[model samples]
Every structure is written in structure tokens, then in C-alpha cells.
Target: MESISITPTIINPKRVFKKTTGEEWYNYYAGFSDDFVSEILNSFELPKDSVILDPWNGGGTTTLNCALAGYNVIGIDLNPVMNIVAKSKFCNTDDVLMALDIVKYLRVNNYPNKLNDESDFLLNWFDYNTASYIRYISFSLQNKCNTILNSKVFSLIFLALFKLVRKYIGKFIPSNPTWVKKAKNSNDKISIESTKIKIDLKNILREKLSATFVDNVSSIGKERFYCASSTKLPLKEHSVDAVITSPPYCTRIDYGIATSPELAVLLGNHPAEIDNIRRTLTGRTTIDKSFLEIESLGLTAKKMLLEIFNHQSHASVSYYYKNFAQYFIDINESLKQIKKVLKRNGYFACVVQDSHYKEIYCDLALIFTEMAEENGLSLIHRQDFMSKFVMANINSKVKKYRDKITANETVLIFQAN
Candidate 1:
């Protein structure tokens, strides 16, 4: 038998992952593809029973891929919707057709005239008719009981159409640049047909759910997942065999604020509740200046924090950096716990990118490498990967700000000595 060597390619920072059919399955938040995860696993020579943990398992990519690879996997995230998404994506189902039937039924009969008045945030983002239709679909699925299979299928459907109601709407003013802004509207009479939208949403949901259903069923084994904060995972010291994750970029991307509007709508949370959610999120833009001062410990981290602090006339840079610094501190603490749980000689593969704060660049991979070394992990290999997906759009003023920083991303690999 011939031995096949596996080499992990360093991606170009300026290159974007080519879009495939499954691309839309993630709604632009697909953190990594299955091939990427598989390559990482192969490089590590991961054991079949190795316990894998992804601290920031956005959209369940790592969890699902790890499970299918026949490893015991645990995923942790602060976002409730992500928890739902992970669960739905990994839970096994016997019949996707039944799930499609449920969606079809809901689409036909659950068209409510109005949502509860308490849902002001939902009303603000979605037109009245669209909001009503979504409310009906959501209400129909609430508390419906079934096997893990049915539940996950329903979740996929709900999650797929979660943003359909407001897909073409205009951007919301005073939004965070890190998050995708809603489109702004110039006219009041935008021709949005409620029935057509619902039908299209239903069809898309069914097709996606069916594909995921077939793929998961065809797989021979399963993986486990956890819906919790990585900062405080449930694992014991030195228990895991490997850790692979890409922590959120510093203050550059606010996960909660970006996804809050959709979360608020799906969860039927009030505006007040949404505000509270935003506050609890790690990368939120609501942090006070005092928090920013506290985060200015790391030289680069502090420098960027101060720059944002000085330029307070435009955006709330302080709040972003403060939250970002908090996230880094949390990651450091979590890595310490991970060390305790990882077995001797275990490996940690981190996929991270450098981010811009004001005009300064923060090399997060390098910072984490130092932090991990301080905590008994040794730096073994560092590979640079190109991520064509630049955070700031080309023509935006922010582009000039980012131009001051490097335009590439890197991935670092570390091992426990």
C-alpha cells in the first residue's frame, strides 16, 4: 500500500473561498468548509475517538464536520441562534419529507394578520405583511415536539427563512460597520408580495433541509455538540485530545449586534430584550470608555484601543476595542482551561486573521501564540493563509482606514509540550 501525504495549503489573504451551491446554505456566515476541517484533522493525525472542541463554532461547520469525521466533538458559542443552528445541523433525522410537510402546512395556514405589539424591533426591520407571515410560521413551530431528526429539520427550515422577510429591505442607519447593515429604502411602496415570498422561502428551506438530511443520514457515525460559552466550557482539565477554533476578530466584528435583529425577530424578543442581548454579547458596541481603558493592556491592543478612543467623533471605537479586548482575555482564560483538559502532547490549531482598529493592525494569531506559550503550549508551526474576504468593502471610507493595515490573514498551529 502507498502512503499518501496530506499537505495543508496556506490560503491567500486576498482570496475568497469560491462560492458553491452549499454556499447559500450558510447565508454568508460560513466560517469554514468541510474540506478545510478535514485537512486540519488529517494534519493532526486525529484519532477516531479524539475529543475535538471548537470554541467559536459559528454555523456548526466544525461540529458537523468533526462528527462526520468520527470524532467526539464539542462546540460552544454565546449566540442562542447558533446553538439552534448547530443542533439542527448535527442532529440525525430519518425523514426530511415529514419536515418539509410541516413547513408546507405552516406556510399555507399560519399567516397571522399581526405580530404581538411588543415586537417593535421586528416591526422596525420587516414590513408589516412580511412580519405577520413570519410570525405565523414561527408560532406554528413553537414547542412542537418530535425526535431529534424532526426538530433539526424544522430548525433548518426556520433558520433558512429567518431573514427572508427582510432580504431586500434597505439598510438601517446608525448600524455597526462590522455587521452587515440592512438596506435602506427610498420609497414606501416597494412591491413586496407576501405569498410569493413565503413560497420562495419554503422552497429554499425544503431543498436545503433535504440535502442536509440525506448527507447526515448517509454518514456512518455521529458527533456531539455543546451550546455554551467557550470562556467557561464544561470539559475537565487535560481531557480533550485537540482544539481547533477561530476566535472572533477583535472589535472588528460584533457578532451579537450583527445578528441581533434576526435573533430578536425569531425569538420574538422585545426591543428592550434585544438591547439586553446586545449588552451581554462579547463583541457588542455598547461598552463604555472605562472598559476600553481596561482593555489597553497588550501593547498593540492598547494602542488600537487608544486610537479608537481618540477618534470618538465618528464611531464608538472605544466600545468596539473594549469588547474585543474582553474577548481576547476570555480566550486566554479559556485556553488555560483547554490546557487542563487536553491530554499530554495534544495539539491546538487556530485559524485567525489580523484585524484593523482605526488605522492600526492587531496580529491576533501572534498574540494568541504568545499567550498559549505562556500557558504551557509550544509554538510548532505557523502558516499564512490568504482570505480574500476583506472586512471593509472597497469604496467605503473604512477601506482607507483598513488600507493602513496589512490586507492578509494567517493561521497558527501550536502543540502542548
Candidate 2:
């Protein structure tokens, strides 16, 4: 099949409602379309034994689609919450339903009063009693899982809990759609009794089970995912036939904070675990304040760095530059890792949107193109779709600086040389 231009909607996750099972389990903000991944499988000439990989497997879109099409696949993400979400894709509906019986043994009043600092993080969004109930259910599920099979069965249950937490906190969804914040007033926090929590979660599970095809139909083994950072992949050299994924956007979205509810559920009571993850994630707003000498950045990236550094806006040099620089460094290392694992002539397909450092255009595709080439991946195909102005919307003040440059949702295919 000859390659065709990708539709702009391929980058949008609006098709999530149109999905089932694991694809419908957790809808991440940065994930691409299921339809798009299906299209890629239909077009790409992947062999039956080909190992497809998504290093930044946000919401498992690429990996799930690849697995569904009967290919050996792996998905990796640093977020533990996503690890559960993605792994839950392999769960059987019968096993998931049977696992719900474990929850009956948990008594709301029996929860430990001695909460960890991280467990307390849930209190801001939920009341103490409700939070305790949540922790009780979470811990009960953890304790009951004795083997790998039970652990994965409980994962499907946790996916329901993850979704239920969001439904419980609908009032907390702030204007910035990316963030789910703690309500300012204590009265605004969610406080459902123990009975409702269990009932609501079970209802969600039952509804989803009836609708979703949870059983793994593929001949290949399940659990084809890992919880790890993108900069350091656990795979061997030249093991992968194709790499398809969208790394975190260069736009400083705090994915850690964006996914606090699910993170709280996965991390059990260790709330501060997110801090380690946030600092580790690419394009984090939190600057680690580390100085890195430029190595892998191409001329285009270096030039953009200089432009952002020279800008007179607040913290352009001290903060924004460092943030962008760190992103470049991390992405460059990830490209190197991608190159190392990809078989010779294996294709690395990426979907990245353009952004800005204040009024300065950060052409992510072009910047990534330079770094990919520097990392020994040669760009073979490029297509750009007109996109809504993201940075301008992110910072309304950018309008004063003649931010006439619009953003592009670009798809670039690079072959490992």
C-alpha cells in the first residue's frame, strides 16, 4: 500500500469513545487515535514475527493496535498508572469479574489510620473518610493478588477504580483541561460513603465488561509492556522492526499532576512517587536546574535555543531555556535509544505538534528531524497538517508579540541507517 497523508484528527483522541476494553480503559490527554494506528498497521509491511514497539506508549494506542493486528508488540512508559492501564489490555473479562469478589473482604472502617505522606495527597481531592475507603480498596486488591495472574486480574479492577475516581471528581476538573486540581474550598471536595464507592466501581466494571472485548485473541503472549523511562529502554539492540509513538509534547504539560487520581490509586499510599516521575518525564515544567553541554542538538535546535535564551521575557534564560534545553537533551538521548534498538532500515514514525517559547516558534518536527539524523536515523517522509494555535492558547500574552506563526501537527517517518 502506498503511503497517504494522515488526517489531522489522527492526533486527536476523540475516537476513544469509539473503542473498547484496554483502549477504552484509560484515555490519556496526549494519546493519538486508535484509527490512525490501525491505518499504520494496514499500510506498513510488518512480518508476523516483527516486534513493534512504542517507547512512549501513552495510553497504549500504538501497542494495542499492533497487538490486535497479530504482531509481537511492546509498550513502555514511566508512569506506573499507565503500566496498569496498558497491562490491563490482556485481561480476560471472566477473570476481571471474578477478581471483584476480593473487594468484599475489605472493610471501610478497618483502614489504617496511620497514613503515609503520599496517601494524604488524596485528601485534598477527597475527604478523609472517602480517601480512607479508597485506600482500603486499593490495599485490599494489592494484598489479595498472590501470583502474576491475580495481579493482572486486579489490574483490570484498578482500571475501573481509576475511571471511577475521575467520575467522582468531576467538580474538580478545572478550566485548564490538562489539570485536575484540588478544590479551593474544603466543602467542594468529594465525599462518598464506602457503600457508594464499591457499588459505583462495580457498576463501571460490569458496564465496560459487557461492552469491551477484554479477552486477548492474539496467538502471541500477553503482558507485552513495561514501566520504564524512554531515555533508557530495556530492549536489546536491533530487536525492534518498527517504532511508532508520540513522545510527550514539548509544551510543558505536567503529566504527573494531570494524572494524580490514577497515580494515587496505583502508587498505593506513596504520594511523593509522582515527584520522581514528574522530574523524570520529558517536557516537564519542573526544571531540575542541571546544566547540560549541547551535543546531539542540530543547528536548528541550537539556533532555537539561542533565540529563546535571548528573549527578554521573564525566566527565558534562567527557566524556559533550561526547560527546552533539558527537553532537547532527553529527546536526543531517547532517539539514540530508539536507534540502538531498531533493526537496520527499521522505521521510526513520530507524531509531534509544534509549540513556542513565548513568541519564538519551536518547530518540534524540524528540531526532532535534526536530532534524529544526528542519532543515525535518516528522515524519509514528512507531512504537516495545519493545527490550532496551541502556545497562543496556552499563553494569551503571546498575542502581543505578533505570534502570527501557526502550529502544525506533523508526522515524520525516519529510517534507522
Candidate 3:
């Protein structure tokens, strides 16, 4: 395949959806399309034995895609729930039937009436009946002493079912609500019958997992997954052949808080554990105030921070940029580590977007590219992709808030010199 030029015009988010199957699962913003990954790998001319690394592997998209492309892959994420998900998707298995059987056993035998008193968040978010049922299933699976070959299968089923239940029953609000006050007054209603919702959810899980497993068995190559911070990867120096990842944006999306309920249900963690989980995450709301000192170290960062502060309130801008700045510094450090491990002339591909903070556009991709160049990497290609999904609806006041930020994202490619 001819290598494409890196430019902002190459990315068409609308086209991404148009090219996909249009399935509900494919529509998920957090999940990457398999076709997109394949295209990226082909463009890179990845060797069959190339070792690929995805530092922020969300939903196992990059890891699984690498496996399908005949490359050895290592995926790292801070979320243990995602670790389970990635493992289930990448690990090869001979007998999916056994996995389904294990799920059946769990479904029949597990039913806890009382949760640990420590789970206040779970109790708050989930009605007792729903909580107990989910707990029973999770407990049964957890107590299974044997490392059942179908553990991943069960986990996928649980995750898929959890999503379905949330969607149908309106168990929680969407992760980002630009205008919470207006949303409350809208005509939308939280509605879904519990029993019907559960059955529908279970059926979808069984179907999706069954199809996914069948596809996985037919694919080639081996893949590995890890649960750790990307800034501190466990791999040895010069071990990987390439790097491909899409780091989180600086848009103050509290991923941990947004997904807290889901993680709690998946891990069966008590409510008390939720706070610990959120606190451990890296992003806008999670970071402490002391990180602002980095401004003295990087001129570009100082300029970006100043711009952010100029448009948004100082407190809000600081709240968003504190962690993002750290994330950049961490990425710079990670790239140094990446340079050590990656083979000479190895490729580094990143899909990133310029995000806004109250209309103040922060060119994070450009900033990171400059940082990477300073750390001994050379920028080879930069492409801008259009993100069609409006961050905030036009008529809403949130759009006015976001217009102060950025409107689009970009993808950049770098190479080890």
C-alpha cells in the first residue's frame, strides 16, 4: 500500500462511521474500528514479526488489530477492567463452548442477596434488586477456583450486558453533559422494565461474544496485554518495534468518574473502592495543584497554559490543563523510553486532537510533536482528521463554552532517528 501523507485534511470522522457496519457497537466513540486499524497497519508496512506497543489501549482495539495483522502486541492501560476486556479479546482459545457452559453455571448458581456494606456507590446507583443480581453473577465467576478457559468470555458477556442494561434502563447519564440544568428539563425520560431489559441484555451479550470468539479463533498472531501506566511501561529497553496509540484528550473528560459505576459493577468493588479508583486516574479532575510548576520548564507549555487561562476562568483552565500538561511531560518521557526500546528507524503513530478549554484552542498534537522532536525523535508525517461529532450542540450554551476551545483533532506520525 502506498503511504499516505500526514495532513489535517485526511481525517474524516464522518467517513469513519460511513465506512463501518453501522452497528451499535461500531458507533461507540471509545471503540476503534477494526478496519481503521487494519488500514493503519497496512500503511506502516508492518513486518510479520514486528512488536507493536499501544500505551493507552482502550477497549483492546489496537491490541486486537495488531494481532489480526500478524504482529506481536503489548497493550497497557490503567484500568484493570479494560485489562480483562483486552485479554478476553486477544487470548486464543480452542473451546468457546466450554466458556459458555461456565457462564451458564455461573448464571444458575450465583445470586447474592446482600452486598458488602462497603459498596455505597453501588447501592446508590443500582437498585438493590439489580445490584444483587449483578453481584451474584460476578461473585460466582470470581469464586470459580479453576482458571476457567472461558473467563474472558464471561467478562465480555458481563461488560456487554452491563452496557445494554445501562442504555435501555437509563441507569446513568452520559459521561459528558454540557448543560445539566437544561437536560433535567428535557422531555427525555428514564425508562425500561427491569425484567425485559435484563433478558434483552443477556441475549445481546451471548450473540456478540459468540460472534467475536468465532472471529478470534480464525485470526493469526499472538498478543499480550498489561494493566499499568503508559509513562511507566514494564517492557525492557529496545524491545518493541513500533508505537501506536491515541492518548486521552485534555478536555476534562473525567473518564474514571464517568465509568465508575460500570467499573464498580464489573469488579464488584465496594463503594469505598470507587474513590480510590478515581483518585488513581490521570486527567483533568484527578491531578493535584502542585503540577503547575512544569510551566517554568517548557516555553510552549507556558504559552498554551497562558492561552487557556486567558479564555476560560483561571480555575477552570488550571483544573483542565494541570493533568494534561503532566500527561505531555509524561509522554515526552515515555517517548524517550520508546526510543530506547524501538528499533532504529522504528515508526511511532499517534492519533490525537487539538482540544479547547472554553474556546481556547490547545494544539496538543503540535505541542507533543515538538516535545518528541526535542527528545530525539523526528516528525515524519502529520495529518489532520475532521471530527464531525459536534462536542456541544449549536443552540446550547455549552457550544459557546466549547467554541473557546478547539473544534477538531489531528493524527501525527514520528520516527526514531
**What overall lDDT goes with each candidate model?**
0.61, 0.76, 0.60
Cα lDDT tens digits for candidate 3, 192-278: 344554566556655554345325345466677666776688898778877877776656566675565456665555655656656
TM-score of 3: 0.80
Candidate 3: misplaced stretches above 4 Å? 1-27, 91-96, 107-110, 145-151, 175-202, 213-219, 289-292, 295-297, 309-324, 392-395, 398-406
lDDT of 1 by residue, 94-173 (tens): 43556567766664443555477744445555666656666666666764754322356666666666546436443452
Instruction: Point out where model 1 deviates above 4 Å.
Output: 1-23, 91-94, 107-114, 145-150, 166-198, 213-220, 288-324, 386-388, 393-395, 398-406
Task: Give one clash count per candidate, in the order shown.
Answer: 20, 1, 17
Weakest 10 consecutive residues of candidate 2 by summed lDDT:
1-10
Model 3 CA lDDT for position 6 = 38
TM-score, each model? 0.79, 0.90, 0.80
Ranking by lDDT: 2, 1, 3
Prediction 2 global C-alpha lDDT: 0.76
